[model samples]
Target chain A: AQSVTQPDIHITVSEGASLELRCNYSYGATPYLFWYVQSPGQGLQLLLKYFSGDTLVQGIKGFEAEFKRSQSSFNLRKPSVHWSDAAEYFCAVGGAYGNKLVFGAGTILRVKS
Target chain B: EAGVAQSPRYKIIEKRQSVAFWCNPISGHATLYWYQQILGQGPKLLIQFQNNGVVDDSQLPKDRFSAERLKGVDSTLKIQPAKLEDSAVYLCASSLDGGQGQETQYFGPGTRLLVL
Candidate 1:
């Protein structure tokens, strides 16, 4: 079974500061990876996805993630974060097909002013 | 285009009671999914539907949980004799097509259920 691990349970960053959330996964073969964000009282929104080809994948809301095969990691990053960026973020791993995603416990992001 | 729609927004039920959630997938979407998310945890797949047929429901707690998509568009999930641990957010999502390698799923706002 594929499983994802997010080391940080919570992260706090000042406005305009750079941000990075660590994610690691365990799968026998190469796996599809995704990043999702959920705000208070809102549904989960896709931040980005990595399937094949490029190791770096760009997403909405000025976020990006790089897939490192050697380390089994796909960490999300942003050059600068705004207050609105504060939310719970999830990292997930999926199979090559059928779209059953296994997700991490999630990391709550706090933006400090 | 409008996103996936889920009703009731929130639901409160007592233990041993029953509750149901409704979901309408995006137009033309062929795959729909239901997930349960506990507090401080990521969402877990409860069931999946491809059109009007079940695709995967291996993780669903069959004894107390049931779901159906009769028309291949709208879906309903029901929990009988709910437990306190059932308190969670139920999210519904739809995708253009499933069983493919790279389908992006759109999510609904979710229904928050509190079992007392």
Candidate 2:
């Protein structure tokens, strides 16, 4: 079974500061990775995804993630975060199980203006 | 295109009561999913439907939970004899395909359930 681990439970950053959220996964083979964000009382929105090709993947909302095969990590990053960027972020990985995604416990982001 | 739609934004029921949640997937989407998100945890897959037929429901606690998608477009999930631990946000999602590992799932604003 594939599982995801997010090391951070909560992260706080000042507005305009850079942000990085760490994610690691354990799967038998190369896995499909994704990043999702959830605002309060709102559903999750896709931040980005990494299937194969490029190691660096760009996503909506000025977000990006780098998939490192050697480390089994797909960490989400943003050059500068806004106050509105405060939300919960989740990291997920999918295996051969037909879209069954194993998600990590979310990391709550807090951006202060 | 419009995203997945879910109804009854919030529901509060006593323990052992029954509750149902409705979901309407995006038009033309062939796959629908139901997830349970506990506070401070990521969403857990409860059931999945490829059109009107179930694809995977191994994790579902069938003794208490049941779901159906009769028309292949809309779905409903019901929990009978709800427990306090069942309090969580129920999310609905839809994807364009059911193939293994390619499609992206779009989520709906979840319905919050509180059981006393």
Candidate 3:
């Protein structure tokens, strides 16, 4: 079965520091990848997605993810972290035309002053 | 465009009780999905609908859970005799269509459920 894994359970960074969240997937075929963020006591919001074409996909809120097929990874990165960026991040894997998405356990980010 | 809408921001019910949640997808969206999100886990797809038709329900626990999307717009998910393990947030998401490459799912605020 297709699955997504986020190795980092928790990450803390000082405000204005760079941030990177790792995501890996296991699937028989190339999968559509997505990154989503969730605030405390709230639903998830899509950050970015990679379907085809470019290996690097840009998303909202100055976030981006690079789809590395060789590594089976689609890690999300931001140049700087803000206090407002403290939230849980999830990575999802889906098929090219399927609506069913398999999401990772999620990584909780903490931005300190 | 208006995002998906869900009712009952929070619900608390004892085990063996019945509960139902409602969701209205974004106008014109052809696909709707219902998910279960545990406290420390990512959302899990429980059921999916494609314009009033059942698209997927493989992951749903049919013995206790049932969902329907009638009129192809609004949906409802019900659990009979809810169990303590059913405590979680229920999320509703909608997209234009699964076949379209531009389809991006929009989620609702979700309804938090606590089963005692």
- Top lDDT model: 1
Native contacts recovered by candidate 1, as a share?
Answer: 0.73
Top candidate, metric DockQ: 1
B51-113 per-residue lDDT for model 2 (tens digits)? 888999988999999999988999999999899999999999999986778578999999999
List pairs with backbone clashes in candidate 1.
none
Runs in model 3 lying further than 4 Å from the true structure:
B100-102
Q: How high is the CA lDDT of each candidate model? A: 0.95, 0.94, 0.92
Per residue, candidate 1 scores C-alpha lDDT tens digits across B30-70 of 99999999999999999999999998999999999999998
Instruction: Compute the lDDT for candidate 1.
Output: 0.95
What's the residue-level lDDT of B110 in candidate 2? 97
Superposed Cα RMSD, model 3: 1.0
Residue B24 error, candidate 2, Å? 0.2
All candidates' TM-scores? 0.99, 0.98, 0.98
* Regions more than 4 Å wrong, model 2: none
Error of 3 at A56 (Å): 1.2
lDDT (10s digit) by residue, model 2, range A1-113: 78999999999999999999999999998799999999999999999998889899999989999999999999999999999899999999997548888899999999888
DockQ-derived CAPRI band for the predicted complex in model 2? medium
Per-residue alpha-carbon lDDT of model 3 for B1-116, expressed as tens digits? 78889999999999999999999999988999999998889999999899999988999999999999999999999999899999999999999886654468889999999999
